[model samples]
Target: MNLRPLRPTDLARLVELNDAAYPAVPITPPEEMTALLGQADFTFGVVDETDSLLGFLIGLRPGADYASENYRYFDSRGADFLYVDRIVIDATVRGAGLGRMLYDAVFALARDEARAEIDCEVNLDPPNPQSLAFHDRLGFRRVGEQETKNGTVTVALLAALL
Candidate 1:
């Protein structure tokens, strides 16, 4: 698989992957995604030999002038972190280590930036056991939990020290 920076052309497939992997997460329209592509601290895709996208990730640095409840929670704590907003892989390619590759790239970026940690959140109310286990295997520990969407959904906020 080839891992590379995300391109404008990749957004549609990315939306499909995101919806499939994380239906609970808010859907981003193409126009919004286009803006985010330029604003995000890091965004990348994993593709096959034919250049078909298999997965993608989006991340933001601390203090970014954006509004995601999870991100704002991290910022409010005054932590220097690289916050992974989302990472989604196509169901067909699950367990192919594409997720790990994306995470390793994020880790490298965090280390390079001298950030204190890598932060992300996993679904809890509408539980995703596989994702929880995966993050545990990656050495992320749950630091906190909170409800969003007017207590409709809860997420376990996780972090791995760099």
Candidate 2:
């Protein structure tokens, strides 16, 4: 497998992978994905030897022109950080180390950019135990929590120092 920058042409497959992940992440429209790509500090795809996208990650830096409540969780804290807006791996490769490879790249960027931490959130309302466990192993702690989408969803604010 190899990691590379995500491009517009990859959106259909990327969105499919993202949607398959479900409320683990909200389903995003292509137009919104385009907008996020514009504001992203980093966006990358993990692909196999055949160049099939296996997963992707989108991260945003502080001060980005983004309106995501998850991003704001860190902003409200006055933290200097890189926020992982979303990450999705194809079900076909879920247990592999691809997620780690994607995160390692983002962590390196956070360090290189002198970010204080890497921030993100995991579902709490519907409960994504595997996701929360993954974040725990990565040293992310619950810094805070919030209910969004009219309280239909609750997220655990998480961060790991760079």
Candidate 3:
């Protein structure tokens, strides 16, 4: 399998993968995704030789950030750090180790950028337990928790020193 930046042609496939992985949670809409892609700081997807997208990772330049609860989380790591907006893998490809592939690519990006840390939040809904476990398995430690619009509590944050 080959890993690459998300292309305009892959947007619809990404939408499908994200929606399938995050059924209860609404995935990012195409318009918002387009704006995000234009930022040039986001890592897009992991695809195979046939160009089938397996998963994706999206993040932003980190700084003083806010949780869903409006609580502030600060990182002194400076401009190099990235705050992951979301990560999703296609269900059909779940057991194939693509998630780790996507993550390692993001980690490599962080290192190449001279980043100090990688951060992200995981939703607390029971159905999303795999995310929490996945992050834990990746060496991220929990920092805190917060609640979202639907009263779904989200584990506030998790970070790994890169």
Sort order, lDDT high to low? 2, 1, 3
Writing each residue's lDDT as its tens digit, candidate 1 over 1-162 gives: 988999988889877777676554667777887877778889879999999999888999888987778888888889899999888888998898999999999999988889999999998988988889999999999999999878878999999998
Residue 112, candidate 1: Cα error in Å is 1.3
TM-score of each model, paired residue for residue: 0.94, 0.97, 0.82
Whole-model Cα lDDT of every candidate shown, in order: 0.87, 0.89, 0.71
Q: List candidate 3 stretches off by more than 4 Å.
A: 23-25, 63-80
* Candidate 2 clashing pairs, residues 3+ apart or interchain: none
TM-score of 2: 0.97
lDDT of 3 by residue, 6-57 (tens): 8999888877877776643457688866766666367768888888888887
Task: Give model 3's TM-score versus the native structure.
Answer: 0.82
What 10-residue stretch in candidate 3 is worst by lDDT?
Answer: 63-72
What's model 1's TM-score?
A: 0.94
Q: Give every collision pair in model 3.
A: 144-156, 145-156
Q: What is the lDDT of residue 5 in candidate 1?
A: 90
